[model samples]
Target chain A: MIDWIESVLHITVQMGTLYLLASLGEIYAERSGILNLGLEGMMIMGAALSFIFTLAYGHFAAIIISIAAGILMSLVLAVMAIHMRLNQVVAGLAITMLGLGLSGFLAFPDIRKNILLSLNPALPEQALMTQEAPKLPEISIPLLSNIPIIGRAFFHHNVLVYVSYIAALVMWFILFKTRIGLSLRSVGEDPATADSLGVNVFLVRYLATVISGGFAGLAGAYLFIGFHPFWQEGMTAGKGFIALALVILSTWNPLRAVLGAYLFGGIDTVQYRLQLFGLGAQSPYFLAMLPYLITIITLILISFENLRKRIGVPKSLGIPYSREQD
Target chain B: MSRKINTPFGVIRIERRAAYPRHIAVLTTLLAVLLAFLAVAIILVLIGIDFTAAFTLIVESFTKPELMLNSVKQAIPICLSALGLGIAFKMNFWNIGAEGQIYVGMIASTGVVLLHAYYGLFDEHVLLPLMFLTSFALGGLWCLLPAFLKAKMNVNEILTTLMLNYVAILLVDYLIHGPWRDPGGYGFPLSIKFPDYAKLLFLFGDTAYTGLLMAILGAAAAYLIMDHSKLGFEIKVVGQNLNVARYSGIDVSKVIMFGAFIAGGLAGIGGLSIVSGIIGRLRPRASPGYGYTAIIVAALAGLNPWLIVLASIFFGGLLTAGDVLQASMNIPKTVIQMMQAIIFLFILMGEVFKRYRIVFEGKSGGDMP
Candidate 1:
């Protein structure tokens, strides 16, 4: 029983880290008053890019490339939502559509069919179809590895997993303790006020969105290399959207983003675990529904005005700011 | 938010226009489309593709009668879904789970068909209407839960509706994989083929025309209700400004619920048409993301029902062209999604520029510099 429990906990942490990385990024973007809904799109691009890059370069370089792809995707969101002052929802949705479509199209069956005007598949495109993903390296702390259950469950994880934790801590400090953090929060809560106080609202928003996009990209790379070690089209599979909910659940707090991600991860893990219980008799589809069901229930609970206020949701979040009018 | 900024060379002032000329709006939209094609052309050239060849491939694909029929047929459910989406979008209700609503509609219609077969129930003529109504009601029921939560608890409908989409999809998946699975189909995750009685009536061309007709009817109804009815005015008022709508003594929650319910109902009809008119079976994955695509169509059409039909058909052609491109150019049809996204991004950018004209002013004499 303990062994079974330990395995689930370990898997839970892995999944939790995936969502944590994404949500932590979202927390920053939302803090800067930009609701980027393209996390899934960006993450998928990261995954697809990492898969191709990993085939060509080593794992670390692939991760970097993936992060760059993520940053690039987020820039699109920033340009639309901040610079152009377009509808964030529409722009974000378009980014997602573009990312998913671009990745999928890039890896289609060798297009060079026997015909008069057959388009040859690019080398990377061909490789995407026939490449085996190399697993990300795992690292176990020296003394911590000897701590038995807790160590095995938490201490021992991949480099990316540890990076997620470190990222969360760094993000938490930046968001809570630092001057830049304050500026970001102020920008999100009241951009007009923030702008009046000489905070470059536009710059802060752009930085926040780009940084968050970087984090989401790392999460995608982690999922592909550390967690699953494989890539599929749309493998980000609404995790981006789930991360969006996690930001609200955590009230835009980076540390809380980690906790909220784990809670969601627990729901996902337990659902999968449930399918194994009762001697493996339960339907996995029913199990799959549990996370979504819990998400709805959680959304309902948090939106009750009481919890929402307690969590300190940014007042100006998701609303475009016009400095001149204010 | 509106803003004006001073640059080094000139002061570029951005001011919102109360309204622009209709011709300019049309002209700008056309220009944007043309720009997108130009961008595509540049991409094609960079990728070593001849534009002439690609154009011929597209035109040739359209000439094929089967492809044209398929494109129109495919456009039907998407148009229906888009019309439904337009109503909710106008009301500021983000019904992201039209995908799930579509599933519920399919499930509801499929259930009726299965039950009819099991109990030796209604005749074809009698059952067809029943299927339509059942699917509509069930779809509305599915959507109502989220709207109810949104109204009562101020719940974020985007997240709730999105989450529900997965639940609805899984429910259908579970049903199809379990009890609903056709025993005679060698364990394929699919329900039995829908009976002919449960099928829709054809108005013209293929029976798929029923779906197109339904979409047209829904769009017309939405146009009338939005432009000519009190409910439409209420929804518009609520959408435009919640405070003003409340001041006008409107039940904001009630208005939200009505629009939302209808949105789901229309999407459900789209789902019903897919099963009854297109697929003819409750398969594991019935929709090819038509519900999601409908959102794009609605936005592209600027929420106009008449324009939605044209946009839907245009998208349908694009989708068909994607396939043709895949066959000829060896590119995946999924590239169309990227093209559509680029077009939408341009649309949003165009909308921003349209709403606010940019004017350059010479730098002031005593500039800080």
Candidate 2:
């Protein structure tokens, strides 16, 4: 039973980091009043771009390129939602569609071959679909990793997982304990007030949005290189959207995001465990529905007015702010 | 939102217009569309695709009769869903759950067919209509939950609706893989082939006129309801200014629920059209993101019912052309998605021009601020 629990926890931590990275980024964006629905797009682009670069230049270059792609995708959203003052919902959706399509198109076998050739003429022409890159090396913390099950589940993992731990902690500090955090919270809570208080609403929003994209990109890189090392069309699957929901479950708090992400990750990790438990014979697909269904329930629970107030739902979220309007 | 551009010579100032003429709106929209195409072409060129060849293939989708039929078939569901979404959008409701609504619609209609086979619940003549009604109701009901939450509790509809889409899809997957799985069909992840009575009649070869007919009627209904009725006026007024609508004694929650129901129902019928009218039976992944594509179609059409038909057809052709391009040029059909996103981005940029006028002030002289 202990062994089973350790294994589940191991997988949960591995999967949970994906959500943690994404939700942390999203928490920042939402805190600055821009709800980016394009996390899936940006993440997938990261996965796809990283896979290509991982094949050509190795993991370091792949990570950088993936981050750049994410930043580029989010920049498009920033321009649409902030500069053009378009509906943030539509802009985010468009960015997601663009991401999905672009990633799929770029990863097509022939396109992948062509891209690889462009990167290195000496490289043999091959489809990326059939290839796998070396997984990120696991870094077991010496003292912490000595602690049996918890150590194996949390401490003995790839560098990306540790980065996520640091990222979440740093983000939590930045969001709640700093002047910049105050600026972001003020902008999201009341941009007009923030603007009058001499906050550069556009610049703050632009930076927050872009930073979210960077985090999303890093999440994608971790998803591809840290978790699954293979190149599949939609390996990220609905993880990006799930991460979006995680943001709400965490109530847009980075610290809470770790708990929320791991909880969902535990749910995700239990798909096989349920099979071993014999419930899979009757309802494996139903189990697949758990995470999403729970997300809806969470949304409902969070939406209660008093609960929302306690949770600190951003007041100006999804509303575009223009200086001239006020 | 700086409306001023600092230049070496002068500062260009942008100011909002009180109102724009219809001609300006039309012109700007056309310009946006053109820019979208140009951008798509440029992207294609950069990706080493023969732009002219791809363009020719896309154009052929319109000129070729057989391909046109495919486009029309594809357009039917998109048109129906977009027309439905137009109702909700007009009231400023972001009902992105059309995708989930579409899935539930498919599930409901599929349920009717399976149940009919098991128990002979109704006569053959009533089967199609029953499928239509059940799918619409289920789809609408699926949408109503989010609307109710949004209306009553101020829940964010976007995430709830989107999350439900995955649940509905998983339900479909479960049904197909388990209870509804075709027993004699070699353990395939599909239900039994829908009976002859359950299928829509085809007009030419595999092309069904039923879908087209339904799309037209749906557009007309949406047109009349949105442009003619008191409900339509209330919805518009509510969307324009919720405070004013409340002051004028409009039942805001009721309008939201009703509009959402209509939107979901239409999207549901779109799903029904796909299973019954096009594919002839339910299967895994029946929708290739038509619910999402419908958002682009509706927005591109400016939420006008009649224009949705044209926009849907245009997108339907693009979708068909993507497949053709994939088959012939080894180009992924997702290029169409890229183009759609570009078009949407350009249209969004055009919205700025429509609402504001930019004037280049002579040189950065004194009193510019």
Candidate 3:
């Protein structure tokens, strides 16, 4: 029983760590009113770059390259949606397409020629499971790791997992306590209003977006180096989208984003755990669907009166800023 | 108000035009698309492929009859899906669930196909009608929940629609992998092969022109209805200004529900087109992101039904050429997909030109005229 419980908790933390990083990044972007749906693309590019660079250099270089890739992709979105003043949703969708395609092209440079391995049958496959990637060594906390199941799950993890937790806490603190956070929030709330009040809405938005890119990149790198240590084209899969959903579920709170990420992460891991417990063998697909199904239900419930009251969305969440527009 | 602005070369005056000429906007869009293509060409060159070979592969996709036919066949599903989704978009409804709608439509059509295989229920005439009806109805039902919520509860349809998409796709994946898996396929995740009578009739080489015609007809119908009908005008009004639409006594809720239903219903037909029309069997990973690409097609065409047909065909050709490039040049399929996305980005970026015009002038310079 202890083993089963410990395993579930360990997997949950691992999955949750990824979601937390991605959602933390998304929280920053959303708070500043930039919805870059290209997150999956950013994550994918980060994963591929991290994988390649890990082999070329090391984990540190991989993380940096992944972050750079994220920033670059976000800059593209900023140019189109921010500077060009195009439709945010359309621009985001396009960026996502570009990100997914380019990353896939780069990652699987010769996969098509090899007939034996499965093609990225998964839309956006990123699991280069065949190749070797050096995994980040786990760092067990001294006294904390000696504790119980909680210690193993929380304290014993790679550098990325601990950093992701710190990042989430830092995001929470910076967003809630800092003047910059207030400025960013105001811009997301009403850019025109913020601009009228002498805030450089453009600068704040750009910074927030780039910050988002960094976290997303770190998440991707962590996904490859810390968790899987191999790459696939679409391996980030729907995690990016799930993180987007988490942003909403958190109701724009970075702390709540952490909670939401872990919650969803637990839901994602539990299904596989069910399969391990021999319950999912008969209908693993049905069991596999638990997470997505839960997201739908949560979305519906969030739309209800009580939850809706709690959820505070940015006023100009998706609108591109234009000086001329009323 | 005319304003003087500083420039690197010289000071310039800026003024907002009341409106730009339609022809000018068209020219700007064309120019943007051309520039975007040039940029992709540069991208190709940087990726170690010669620009000429890439250009040749694209040209070959259109020049070859077989490739062109394949393009049209692939285009049918995207066009149909885009046209359907375009209606909701016209009302500013984010119906991103077209992917799920299309998947379920396929599943429903496959269900009908299986019926014919097992029970021998009715003739092809009746079965085909059943297939179309079931597919459309199921797809509509799938989206109705979100639409109803958006209208009544004032819920965000974007989240609901997108989440439903995952649910629908996972359900399809489940079916193909387990209960629906064909025993004779040697562990491949695919449903039983559809019977001949259940398949869509072909008007081309081993492919169905039925879907392509349906897509064109659907577009025409959408064009007529969106431009000419009262419902379309109401949708436009609601999309442009919801409060104003409500003040005009347009029964905004009904419009939302109806628009979503029709949109989902049309996407359902698109799903049926591929399953019954092209693939002729249910399989895992059957769709190559047709529903997602449908959004680009719809957006690129400015949500105009007729133009969506063109955009869909263009995208379809890119897909075919992508396959060809993969086979001949060893290029990844993603390169073509990236090209499609770049075009989408360009179209979106060009939107500013539709509403605003750019003027280049030196310091202290007056209008050209």
Candidate 4:
């Protein structure tokens, strides 16, 4: 029972942290009125770059470089969707296809060979048996570690998990409680109105996209060096897209984004556990599809009319705003 | 006071600016294609390849008999899908789920073939038509979901359609890996080889020419329907503006549903063609991303059914050349994808410029620089 509990906790932490990182970036972009559907493509590019660079250099430097590459690639999307006033959704889709193609081409050789370099286990002093998977270092809070459930969930996690939580909190605060957030929201709500009020709408959209790209890149890096420590073709899978949907499901709220991520992470973890318990051979495939299926159902349930009245999506989301139009 | 401007005509003179006719859209498309080619050439040069040699290699692949046949064979499915897509786009309905519909068609066709084989129904002459009908019905039904959701529930078709593609893929994956796995095959993730009676026979000797003929028929039929029919007029109206369409007493929902059904049905035929004519067995990667590629073809062709036929052939040739480039020049197959992306960007940008002119206002007297 204790072992099972430990494994569940481990899976939840890893998946939740990865998703939180990606979805938070997505939250910012969508909140700014640019539906960056290219998140999946961006994440894939990040994964491939980080994996390749980590194999060449060390993990930390690869993380930094991958983030930079992601930001650079996102600028291409911004140039077309923001500056040129092209359709945001199509531009995002094109960016995804471009990223997927480029990454597949560059990473084909590595993927075919399955040449994954394993990370060394941290803390040689620990007496527990080391598994093949590299163990992330955990920080135990002095007094909080003694508490029962909440203590294990919050206090004892890898540095990435803590960083992701802090990032989400900081993002929530900045987006809701700050003057810049107000301006960004105004731009999203009514770009022409914002522009009339002297807000640089174009600049804000571009910045939001780049920062979103940065976060997506960090998520990709976390997937490789931080989570799995391996490389595979189409490694990011559809997680990036799910993150985009989560942004909507969360109603662009960073806190809800975390909750949504954990919910999905929990579903993913339970699916694996069900497979381990031998539900059926096809159970895993069905489980793999749960999150996407839930997203579709949730999307249908969350009608645009309801969202418009209450949660209120960006008025100009996915529509390219031209200053000259008004 | 009005002033008369002199013209090339002997006596009659008029001050006039040339009107931008609808045909200018075609010219803009051509210019976009040219720009895309130039961009591809520059990228080739940056990647340390001789652009002339690479392009020549691509062009030469089209002349070989086998490669030429392959190009047509590949174009057949894409052309059919594009026909449906063109109709939908003309009606301004973005039916992006052709990929999923195609998968559904493949599954339905495979199921029919399997059932026939199990029951010894392949010995009968009616098996082929039965398989085709089943596939088309399945494909059409798959499309009905999103169409219903969009027309009724007002859900975004793009996201729903895309998500459905993943679901269809997974469903197929489960079947191929589990129940549909051929007992005779030793651990191969493929179904049994389909019987000859269940297959689509070639019109010519040992070629997928029958599929090509069907595609041509489909394109021609779509052209006739879209151009000569009242239904086509309603589609055009609905696509241009739904409120206008409603005001004109056209049932907008029915038009959308009809368009989607036809689109999904055509994609279904494409799937059936693939299983019966090419692979002859079900596999996980049954499609080579043809459904998505059809979007590019349809857009590049300006959503005209007849033009889609020509565009599909061009894209088919590109796919053939991409394979050749992969084999001989050691270029990644993704270069073709990159070219497609570049073309889409250029075409979209060209459309923007064609619609709207940008004028720079000078604050002071300065040269045109």
Clashes of each: 0, 0, 14, 1
What is the C-alpha DockQ of each candidate? 0.57, 0.69, 0.48, 0.30
Clashing pairs in 4: B91-B239
User: Comparing only chain A of model 4 with the true chain A, what is the TM-score?
Assistant: 0.87
lDDT of 1 at B359: 73
Instruction: Report the lDDT tens digits of candidate 2 across residue range B194-283.
Output: 887787664443544667777888999998998899889998998899999999999999999998999999999999888887787888
Estimate, for each residue in A1-326, the C-alpha lDDT of model 2 and write its tens digit. Answer: 78887889999999999999888988999999999999998999999888888888889999999888888889999998988888988888888888888888888888787788788777654534456777889988999987877978899899889999999999999989999999999999999999999999999999999988998898899988899988787677778999998888888999999999999888878876787787756476777777777778888888777888888999999899976753
Candidate 3 docking band: acceptable
Best of the two (1, 4) by lDDT: 1
Native contact fraction per model: 0.82, 0.78, 0.66, 0.38
Which ranges in model 2 have alpha carbons more than 4 Å from their true place? A125-129, A275-278, B1-6, B202-206, B361-367
lDDT at A277 for candidate 2?
A: 82
At residue B314, give the lDDT of candidate 4.
81
Local lDDT at B359 for model 2: 87
- In model 3, the fraction of reference contacts reproduced equals 0.66
Model 3 accuracy (lDDT, Cα): 0.80
Ranked candidates, highest lDDT first? 2, 3, 1, 4
Candidate 1 stretches with Cα past 4 Å from truth are A109-129, A270-282, B1-12, B360-369
**Which number leads on DockQ?**
2
lDDT measured at residue A317 in model 4 versus the true structure, 0 to 100: 71
Candidate 3 per-residue lDDT over residues A190-209, each given as its tens digit: 99889999999999889988
